[model samples]
Target: MKNKTVAAWLAFVGGPLGLHRFYLHGMGDTLGWALPIPTALGLYGIQRVQQFGQDDQLSWVLIPLLGFTIAACALVAILYGLRQPQQWNARFNPQASADAPAGLTNWFTITAIAAALMVGAAVLMASLAYSFQHYFEYQIELAREISQ
Candidate 1:
């Protein structure tokens, strides 16, 4: 197994913003630029949900649910990129092909993570929503039985 570098870890944890790709290409300045969108959207989404009177809900819970989904995807991309032998092996052996094509590791990994997260979130939301709706219906039925 090849030893991993900070760049590899970053890429495996934040590749959706192409940070790993940038770092691999010697563009280290782009490393931290990958966070603004999701961060802003997360804050904005939570605030919007709060304004709708569901303040009882956790602030973090309203983050479009997509933010976590996106972060998870970024993590996967970084992991995928980290898995490529060429990326790590070449780290120690700089004379190795410095310009070979980056594999689908970034794309596929991120996409798969995003898809799975979205599906999971959707299912959870649906289940909770259904339970809440059923609970209200049950309460109404009980009230009618008691009144009758």
Candidate 2:
């Protein structure tokens, strides 16, 4: 049976790698395969920043894909952790009874949820802030050039 805690932890810790999806939906899950693409591009973006400096426009776009993907995964973890046992079992452990131990919420699940929430929110906010800050700065530079 797919344990709720395991899923939650995986989503939070390895969501960018799609580990949770693999655990719950098996290796053939298309989404599981797709999740890493953006993550890889995002890592590439980080590499670009290091190599070319932060002013590389491509990095600005690519880096946020990583952050958003991570945030989304964290959200999935929180959702999994908060699910009622019946609902969780009904969806992920349909072959098992509702009261299956794997479906039950425990302190570990709560901890995963809390960690996901905190980390997700921070990453999301940072990404938005980074994107918007650079956008406004770019706009200002363009305006200055146009005025000149």
Candidate 3:
């Protein structure tokens, strides 16, 4: 049986790899393995765009996919952290005795929750900033072209 704290921490730290899903649902969870595909592509696209230029159309697709994946992972981590102890135990540890340690009150669990929230918020804000910057820069370039 997986501990809630452990699973939540994994999701927060390595969610793109679906490590948390593997821990909770085991190797049979295809989604766990597939979640990283776009993340990898997106990262590669980012590198390509950085090396070449923003005109790299592939980077546009990949970066947005990566951003979406990050946001989804953050949401998953937050949901896992917020799950009720009883529900979590029932879902993930039904085979274990009811008296088994739930680990919900542990310091690690609290820390993971806090970290997920902070990281999620930061990533979300960064994505928004990047989007706005790109949009405004495009507009400025268009205005300059039109004025000329």
List, residue by residue over 15-128, the lDDT tens digit for candidate 2. 999999999999999999999999999999999999999799999999999999999999999999999999999999999999999999999999999999999999999989
Clashing pairs in 3: none
Scored against the true structure, residue 103 in model 3 reaches a CA lDDT of: 32
lDDT per residue (tens digit) for residues 7-122 in model 1: 44444445445565555555555534655466566566667666864432343344644455445544544454446657555653455564434332454555544554555456
TM-scores for the candidates: 0.36, 0.98, 0.84
lDDT score of residue 1 within candidate 1: 26
Candidate structures ordered by TM-score, highest first? 2, 3, 1
Between candidates 2 and 3, name the one with more favorable TM-score: 2
Indicate which candidate wins on lDDT. Answer: 2
Whole-model lDDT per candidate? 0.51, 0.96, 0.80
List ranges where model 3 is wrong by over 4 Å. Answer: 55-57, 139-148
Candidate 2: C-alpha RMSD after superposition: 0.6
Task: Give the TM-score (vs. native) of candidate 1.
Answer: 0.36
lDDT of 3 at 55: 69
Q: What does candidate 2 score on TM?
A: 0.98
List the pairs of residues colliding in candidate 1.
11-78, 12-78, 12-79
